[model samples]
Target: MAAFGQRKAQRLARADASRKGGLDERAAPVVQLLNGRARFCTTSSCSGRLVLAQGSAADANSWEVQKKNCTWLMVTHETCTKDDVMTALEKATGDVVLKFEPFVLHVLCQELQDAQLLAVRSTHCLEVPLSHKGKLMVSEEYIEFLIHVANRKMEENTRRIDRFYKCLEVALKTAISANNSPSQETENRSVYIHRRKRKTIQEQDVHTSLKDHNEELEPEDDTESNLAIFAEIMI
Candidate 1:
């Protein structure tokens, strides 16, 4: 844990040095809260944003260089103009996707259990929804969560982005709210523990039933992958 803190501080220093611009006004508070905690530390994060990305053809480069490949025609932490969206579209050579991302914080927790506790506490206590994306690249490091205020979706994509942009204030308010009460945190922790135990029991039951039936798990098929590829091509 001490080692983790050292590395995290080092990274934060590097990040601070690398930043040429100021922090997003809306995301600053959330970032401060996560960084101030002993049990939690923020990794890479962006306050929710709207980005105009060119299609895959424009990304002839490697997937690892996707960030470089995609032209961020517009990057905003708050509501944006429809005129700006139109301007980006005019500049796009390939398909353009307007991605509306909510303020997302990739938080590192001291322990796996601690990750769960933080997730529930932040959501239930602080009204921030979080997604548990499993472990990090470093084996010695701790668990991480993709904590954000919104869900990623392609449904009515542009319309959704516009709508989210319009309601950006509400989202920002929730993200920056000082709603973390001690009682709420305790209740959230208890609920998270209960859910974890229940999940473990369910997994055990499934394992026992599979053993009793002597049923072997089937190998994964490539049908879904092929279908996804076909869909991508069609798109």
Candidate 2:
């Protein structure tokens, strides 16, 4: 009876220990990866929190989640801001903000594959299960480099646009001024021509009057000479 009782007691202790182990697993950290969806990194047994900042240090292990020293990402979103990215990462996960450039984004996949070679060459540390994002094979150096390059290209594009708009404004203003000035000049020229035309018509009327007066005086002189001839005959 004593032996049977001891065996049952031992079994109960083992069951208690197993339960404790399960709880410990639950206490472990949890990492969330965003890829058009929010997915937890660990299985049912693991639960905690950690944050990894891209191009910077990892956050506190208040809830311990593993973070890689080398991981690359090519984040593409039109409406997503830097703040939005940080907010998504607030719950102890990596935040890699990759600004998109069509010119660079096209070639980035190949460059990331090359960078993976360097990452594999690094000293072997304990493998922290990475919450894979997409099909882009990338390393930490590649991600950091790409982010900076993309941001620089964005700045250059903004400057180019500003210069283009300034030139357009200047051209439009010049065209408008030319059009308005010519209109005023044309009106002045029309008024001058109208006055000249009026003066020419008045001069032609004056010449006609002088010609008629000379014709009438010639006829009167001929009549006076006829009378003088008649008077001499009488004498």
Model 1 C-alpha lDDT per residue in residues 116-163, reported as the tens digit of each score: 544421221112111111111222111112112112222233343344
Instruction: Give candidate 2's root-mean-square deviation (CA, Å).
Output: 37.8
Please list the C-alpha lDDT of all candidates, in the order they appear: 0.50, 0.36
Candidate 2 wrong stretches, greater than 4 Å: 1-133, 183-235
* Candidate 1 regions with alpha-carbon error over 4 angstroms: 16-22, 58-66, 120-235
**Clashing residue pairs in candidate 1, if any?**
48-102, 48-103
For candidate 2, lDDT tens digit of each residue in 115-153?
A: 332121212111122222321235545544543544554
Model 1's alpha-carbon lDDT is 0.50
What residue pairs clash in candidate 2, if any at all?
28-47, 29-48, 30-48, 50-92
TM-score of each: 0.45, 0.25
